[model samples]
Target: MLTSAIWLPATLAAGLFQAARTAIQQRLRATLSVNGAGLVRYLYGLPVALALWFGYAAATSAHLPPLSPTFFGFALLGGLLQIGGTNLLIMAFGERSFVVGTAYAKTEAVQGAVFALWLLGEVLTPLVWLGIAISVVGVMTLSLGGKGLKLRDVFGALWQPAARYGLGAGLLFALTSIAVKRATQTLGDGDVVLRALTSLVAVVTLQLVMQGSYVILRERGQWRAVLGSWRTSMWVGLLAAAGSAFWFTAFASAPVALVRTVGQVEVIFTLLLGHFYLREPLKRAEALGLALVVIGVIASVVGSG
Candidate 1:
């Protein structure tokens, strides 16, 4: 994967699938407890993750790298961080309006750049950094939901609880991305797809153990509720697993920060699906924000190559 440009499409597909996964998760939420719904993301995903790994290996006759302690160290750290980041995001959404909290969480790209630079020495070109900035601005603009709030007003609200949770989530997620990249790289240069699949399986399995156990112990009742909603829950897991597979592939091949910068297009996907698909009028601010996000994604892609 590193020898080619598959990372770009992989990242884009990751975003698209993530949007779809979130949609399914939302439907799951109607009948399941928050924990139950969240559990479905990893619980059902484990099977899919396992299937993808075995399927890829079988088809490609891929060589499995020796699993080192270092790989497990990074993968475990990434799994835990991802779990924390997700909970923080839910808190952020609860603390403020969904749009506002989501905008703040969308700062992951910028935060990812910082963490990747600090942890992995992944220095980005200036133009790529600029592109990340523009994409973030667009995300914030769309978060306004055409409420006519000034952009500065968002900054003014940073002292609130929502900002803390949002920023914290972004920070953790950035670190998660860094850890994932490091985990994949620990295998050295080899089959990119195989390496990515291996890491994905490791991370998802860790998630299943940690998060699944929690749900079983603390919210045993949620298991029945989730099972009752299996029709929707399984789709959520499938989408999440697919999204994660693409993300792992991208991270295994490219700079984590650049991949994340491109993944910011997920917000654009949400906008298109939520509004245009529903026949809602696109607000002027949202339109401008869309334009900025498009330009930013382009700049990041071009600057990286």
Candidate 2:
């Protein structure tokens, strides 16, 4: 459980950082919708993250992962999934509240645990399974907090052709976690460094594609709102960088299960942040979802322990 011990603080830090990421995204949206500012946010965020990693590497003497074409290929694939998932999530934000969108996204935990087991040969005990189950219930509670969910609605969402967008985003996010685990393992001792670099490359490349397309096809002013809010952009970039650094470190240090299980704390923190920062109402169902998420994730970790 030493990993768990390290993971506890990492979890706390990651949650706070994730909360900050939420704040950044809101600021981004307010300043610049999912338009130009969004693209700028993605592009600007990478360097800030890089600077932090440089500082960290300086302090820790972490060397860059020795890159071959192989390293680049693995990292490139990982970055594609990571950036694609994030793009989906950003798009979803316009359609749903951050709480709803993120809760759905956090279903990545169950997906991640499964992938870690299958791809990385990471094993979970029965207790961990219980925890995962508990967390899934919590996620569902939060996701369906608004409506009176019938079993049919859930099934409908699953089979609903229209709901495919949201489900696709979630599935892509799950795959991102899998790719990340693979890159980290492949990078060996420089897992953290590689993860940071990979994310930086992935995000920047995606932004280039998006922004270039927007520049070519859309109105010139489409990006006006994006860069207009400089203050928010700066803050969003800062928070995004900090959160990425902390999360990448956690991923490098702990087993993906424990890291992700603890990572579910983001929902709890996000709920609180939403209530206070966004003045959102806390519904009973959502509260239950939050509790279940925390308990389920904890149960899985503790049971495994």
Candidate 3:
């Protein structure tokens, strides 16, 4: 029972670990290319993912489930979309302001709801919709903070490169969530955590093969730097693996939209970490934004329950 009832808890833990991983990955950015740094997680995290999968398989006395065509399809689609979405975010960050780019990227929650509805035919309760809306607004407010961005600035910049890149990333990420969720379901009624771990192993392996090849061909030089700073990079991998495991767990246990809507708590974790760990100042809007996020998460949980 310790791990049996771990849906929302997994989501919360995923946010924390993801926040930590992002912080570490930020440090890696100083020395490695974006692709290289991104590669480190999947490259190094593969072993961890495999270990977790096998461990759970043994723990549950579960035989390796037969992999289905639908599973592979969604797994591959989710992996590829995750990579593409991440790359689009890089483009958005490069081509436009972080505030505006993040504001758009944060729309993944709402987009996820739509994707879940369209792709997975998941219908949500009204309270969950309220949660999604409130959380999204809070996220945008937090993102646009200190930039003097108005509602008009956020919506009016349709022609900007960031708009396309950020929104595209958001949609792709939304799809990735749906695809991953579907992938797990194809495994039948095995343990949810085991199903999730199995899917994580598959997706991470696919991503590693795809991205690892690119890194080897294009960013050959980054390997040396990546290894040189392995002390930090290793932690990045571990945190990434853990974060991904928790997220996959949550995805398997719940609706993707609800999972993502609740997952917006990641922003709160980010802000709090910045304030306490990094000694950063919390702006007024940010404080207000965090409050709204909390409210939204509560609403989402209550609706789901």
Candidate that would win on lDDT: 1
lDDT of 3 at 203: 95
Task: Give me the runs in candidate 1 sitting further than 4 Å from their true place.
Answer: 1-3, 93-101, 147-151, 159-163, 276-282
Report the lDDT tens digits of candidate 1 across residue range 1-305: 13558899999999999877765575555577666777888888989999999999999988888899999999999999988887776666567554455566778999999878888888888999999998888886776666544757776666778888888888898899999989999988888888998999999999889888988899988888877888888888899889999999999888888899899888877666555443435677777877888899999888887
Whole-model alpha-carbon lDDT for candidate 1? 0.82
What tens digits encode model 3's per-residue C-alpha lDDT throughout 208-255?
999888888998898788778878888888898898899989888888
Local distance difference test, per candidate?
A: 0.82, 0.64, 0.80
Q: Which ten residues in a row have the lowest lDDT in candidate 2?
A: 157-166
The clash count of every prediction, one per candidate, is 0, 3, 0
Q: Model 2: runs farther than 4 Å from truth?
A: 1-5, 30-38, 146-150, 156-163, 190-224
Hey, what RMSD does candidate 1 come out at?
2.3
Structural RMSD, model 3? 3.0
Q: What's the TM for model 3?
A: 0.90
Model 2: per-residue lDDT, tens digit, 17-126? 76767656764665454555446555557678667657766787767765456655555665566556666666656666767666676767777778778877778788
lDDT of 1 at 116: 85
